[model samples]
Target: MPQPSVLIAGAGPSGLVLALVLLQNGVHVRIIDKERTHRIGSRAAGVMARTLELYAQLGVLNDILAVTSPFGPMASYDFGELVPKSKTAFLFEHQEPTPDIPYPNTEAVNQTKHEGVLREHLAKLGCTVELAAELRGFEQSAEGVMAKIMHTAEDGRQNEETATFEWLVGTDGAHSVVRKQLGLSFLGETRTEHVVGLGDIVVEEGLGMDVAHMWFINGKMILVRPDDVNNKMFSFLYRTSSAEKPLTREDFVEEFYRITGRRDVKFGEATWLSKYTPNIRMVDTMRKGRVFVAGDAAHCHTPTGGQGLNSSVQDAANLGWKLALVYKKLAPASLLDTYAEERMRVIAHMLGLTTALGDTNRANMGKKDFKMQHPDAMRMLGVNYRGSSIVCEEPGAAEGVDDPYMGGVGGRVQAAYRAPDASELVPAGKQDKTTRLFEMFSASRHTVLVFGGDAGTRAPVVKALEHFPATGVIHAVLVLGQGNATPSDAPSFATVLEDRAGHAYKGYDVDTGELAVVVVRPDGVVGVVASDAEGLERYFKKILIAA
Candidate 1:
């Protein structure tokens, strides 16, 4: 059978990630960008820990970390006097890493560099972003979508082209043509009253590169932080009601002196500048038939919490694997609906959280109310889809209640929750190497963690799963307790691992003598939690199509 083809609109981080993931899953993809040149400046600065975990799975976390720095030790200034107390200015508080949670802190890098990392990875997969190409319109039917794209040549000649694809995805920014064309309502309010000037600039000297500097004077706030590129370059955001004329380099310099009450500060050049009016809007639904929208195309929110790019890229991750499965005929088309069902909930809560943070920021302009801004929820590790249609939990499981932002109430991994990563697992009687749970997941297969019970209870579950090939849709992993011998009757298709430190069992909350199966989706979300073979069969029935 021919591989399914997908067209991704917009070459931002979201579009590029979706394309890269689809290509890795053996899907054909064509990515396009409306902008003639790539985006620049420190637009979205915060890369959440959850996003870093996904990047690790995609094998681009190291590349991204190479270009970024850890965010910390923010300093505040009041009326030209440095505050005696130093406080962290990030949106989320830092947590110490545990055995299950690997990345516990957020990383800071400008969106421009972030997109560049994704673009390079996409190129490695034999795909490149087509620049100066615009998606004019599209119409989708039962089988596929007919898209009209316009390409502009260097000679200023424009040519129209038509293409057909099995699916269409829009990662285009806030003013997404795909969303508008589909007539999906971008519903929400625009905070014009809270306008600010945001951009990157070159400073010859004066500001400390080690810490973020914030000056709150005359009931206005101006923040300056070192650019991820280098110390000589910095990014600034100044809140002002009057930006009647376009904000220029002179305007930023002049405003900086006025707000800081210091004549010694110097500005070399303003490489980029723009006005930001917070727009809180999102589509009612992320998908309509064969055409879909992800990232900024699906939702837009205040940049207070820095959830924009992370949320959008996650949307791509959630949709990419599902599309690949449907095309490969391993899953039914109904599996696609769960993307909208799951992401919409997270996006809606994210919009509210960021909006609240923006409001708190505006309220604390000249006050010392920094405590109201940062919260654990902003870390995004707590975000879950407990109510997703495809998430199957064992009978009588707690199934914890769901909150819009905090997710379910559980200390351990639950259905539809982000799968916790456990490290230092050793093969039975093998001492040479250690393995992590995350290494078992791939874009092409589901990871099934089987917590072995007694020989009597474990054999049936393992034997029944033997019918499903581990190299195919399901990759079964037999996790044995410490000092337990590998059973001779263990399925040949399964990969056996001994939890040397007991971290896997404790992290996953598996009972000592009860059989349990934790099925993780391709995107690393907990898909199904079952205790028996019949329960696992029901989950596959819901997602996979019968041949």
Candidate 2:
């Protein structure tokens, strides 16, 4: 019943995710969608490793894993041939799980189911998406944002209501009303020459579910991928000429038969169907005043690397915690500006990457010898905010590194990088069992990790953190060396762990006996890497408001 602090104008995965992050941080939110019902389709189905790690932080990994499957190999067949001519290499190389990267592979799950899981989590947090409620317009002042929302009743009557909130986020797809109203220039190209018909359909038999079936016929490509574990449902993407009119289920069926020349496969009803033309566009900036944009609203590209939905979710994650801190008066409002600063560059790089992949895909449609391979960068674990203004790296740390998609598996541990997970840590009193660094991370606060130092050595760092609120905004974790005992003066609120197997030290690149401190932001990004309390204080000063 408390007035919502944030108004999110889309209920897709991006909006739902932002709402969940804010709710977890105790920030109330109102998420609205213009559609009467959630969309159904296998639109953006590839969930990458980086997204999986983020899902873990939000406590939705188990549910997501339940409904998703690993990316399967693409099996290409010659036209009119039932047998596959060749099995194209896996789009991404299979990497085994390591201590640093737990989720090493991409998973496949439709956008609809993905949104459902996120919505379920939001409901548990006591928030629901306001269906049939459309954000018509909004105006912002220095204090807050006043939004005009149009609500439709069951009988089709409509009423416009004015609502006030501290912040507004537009996650409302590519045709974002928020972006248009804000007058943000969406500068990019739309490739009308390339069009594809996409939909999910049920096939009773004559298709294997383990691999994606691909056929290049008459200078067009038809890619059919298994949609579910039941083996009866599948999703298809059919390349169509610009001359062709908008496609229906009947048209899709007719084309499928004509393109593949397969009569043995029995077709059932199509669950969803639509035409897709790569928009390949992005806003000049993700923010304008108190209102902001994320997901497809900010940038949209071809789904070549399966990065669209994942990048959108990442955009929400980056903005969510920053918004919460500013809303709670824990951090300065200027902190929200960093959202556009960090995400815009990354989205630009993503657009280029997907565009190149799409170009390659179109060019290689009929090339029998071409093999499709996605670069490891598509995993997104390598994505970093290396040059972010808020991140601080101490003297002698790696500097001048230009790679944004660096530092995932086997990469150096430094400031502004994704904080790698460390396992086999023994808690203060529990020698029989152990936990991981990820288990200690919370979406609600910044985690200050004090590594390899005893109580006397770490006392300065702990004392410095005392300047900030300890209840919900900041937490300290002391990771002692293998033989080091728990510090006698350790703060009651601090968690003490022993790096028995050195996994923590190795993952963090900290020497066994060297003392170090890593400040991890609420979004699981390493905010700062330092050797002393002064470094920790300086980083927090940039992030938290002075007490």
Q: Which 10 successive residues of model 2 have the least lDDT summed?
A: 393-402
lDDT of 1 by residue, 186-280 (tens): 98998878788999988786676778888766677888888854548888998867656788888888878888876667778887899987889
lDDT of 1: 0.82
Per-residue lDDT tens digits for candidate 2, residues 411-496, read 66778778889888899888899998888777788888888755677778777887887668887888888878767866543788
- Clash pairs, candidate 1, are none
lDDT of 2 at 364: 77
Can you give the lDDT of residue 436 in candidate 1? 85
lDDT of 2 at 297: 94
TM-score for each model: 0.94, 0.96
Please report, in order, the local distance difference test score of every candidate based on alpha carbons: 0.82, 0.86
- Cα TM-score of candidate 1: 0.94
Whose lDDT is greatest here? 2
Model 2: how far is 203 from its true place, Å? 0.6
